[model samples]
Target: MTPPITYDGRHLLADLYGCPLLGDAALIERALRDAADRAGATIIGLHLHHFGEGHGVTGVALLAESHMSIHTWPEHGYAAIDIFLCGARHDPDAALQSLSDHLAPTRIVRHLIRRGEAP
Candidate 1:
């Protein structure tokens, strides 16, 4: 007998710069949904937060596979994004790529962490 080949997922953390903070929340949310859909993930829920002075954060994207989150610092022109999807057929990379493209960051640092694997 053999152990089942369980599919592990990756958690992506991205540090981005040069992101425009003005009137981009709707666009960002749309892009996130599109990405998740393309990756075969269901968008169960979403939340967006806006700072009083045209700066703030957004998060709470619940996906069937897992979840996606983002925090924005418009004052510093930076944003941090996290995407975690757990499933045998979810493409987290594609979701991240879509976010990067939509944000149009001048510079980006991304880290991928593997989770739920046997040690």
Candidate 2:
């Protein structure tokens, strides 16, 4: 059977404020993984980076559908998250919600956009 046509993908960019997530590398990685699962995206690989003491953490989860990345500023109680997934099987919005729930941010600014159209 022929596969259905795939069009643009969903991309969610979020800014989190007053987050309790304080530069924990492992937690960030886990959050990304959980978000990917919530979005129904397949995780291919994960990479995490830890900065100096009291700096922050950065992590990226490479998914079969697309990718999810996060950077935290614990001192500022802020985090930046990007979740992009291709195809209709996955929902970036769900991932965003899951991440937000995990982080428990007091203020959230979210932007959803469509990326890349069908050829």
Candidate 3:
């Protein structure tokens, strides 16, 4: 079997632990935008939704290369971020760093998966 050529890309799973400002949807949006910018990714559109005050926030940035998503739990002081960008033009690690800088998580854990890899 062979993998499709179009499947090539980088996917980053970022876990922000002991983070703050998870309830701030506006900040999260800004962070996402900054992350995309830092990664040199083009944003076609973006959307953010806040569950409620003192609750969680969900945000997604639609990029030309792919997408970046964030789900926050303010009560738990945690945020889960996923950044998947296609092609080699974008740096998903920079996006993750941007998110960490904006949110200032006490601890961060991340994994990068290379897409389109043959089994």
Candidate 4:
């Protein structure tokens, strides 16, 4: 008998602090794209939402493997991030680590999920 194949998906929930209010949207989006590229995931599209008056932005990057997304509230000193990827050569954990390191969140809550079924 043959064993089923599986892929790893990591979901991260983070509480960020001391993040820059203005111009952080582009920085985060860029970091995500870089991480995706390092993980061997192809970037499809990215959308960023900027709120007025230092509120922050919500950014989402769609990848060929899956997606990486983030929502920020600089005023409250918080951010929520999620990264999901499914493929043979993609490493979702590396992507998650890259984001965490870039953001430098003071408090972090992370979860890992293994997805898909046997062939």
Candidate number achieving the greatest TM-score relative to the actual structure: 3
For residues 4-101, write the lDDT of model 1, one tens digit per residue: 65668889888989887533677768867877887788998888876656776676689878898888887777888888988758887888788877
lDDT of 4 by residue, 35-77 (tens): 7877788999999988866787888889888888888888776
Off by over 4 Å in 2: 1-6
User: What value does the lDDT take at residue 61 in candidate 3?
Assistant: 93
Off by over 4 Å in 1: 1-7
On TM-score, the stronger of 2 and 4 is 2
The TM-scores of all predictions, comma-separated, are: 0.86, 0.90, 0.93, 0.77
lDDT of each: 0.79, 0.89, 0.93, 0.73
TM-score of 1: 0.86
Worst lDDT window (10 residues) for model 1? 50-59
**Which candidate model has the greater lDDT, 2 or 3?**
3
Model 2, 56-98: lDDT tens digits are 9988899999899999999999999999999888999899888
The C-alpha stretches of model 3 lying farther than 4 A from their native spots are 1-7
- Each prediction's RMSD over C-alphas, in Å, is 2.5, 3.5, 1.7, 3.4
Candidate 3 per-residue lDDT over residues 62-98, each given as its tens digit: 9999999999999999999999998787899999999
Where does the lowest 10-residue lDDT sum fall in candidate 3? 1-10
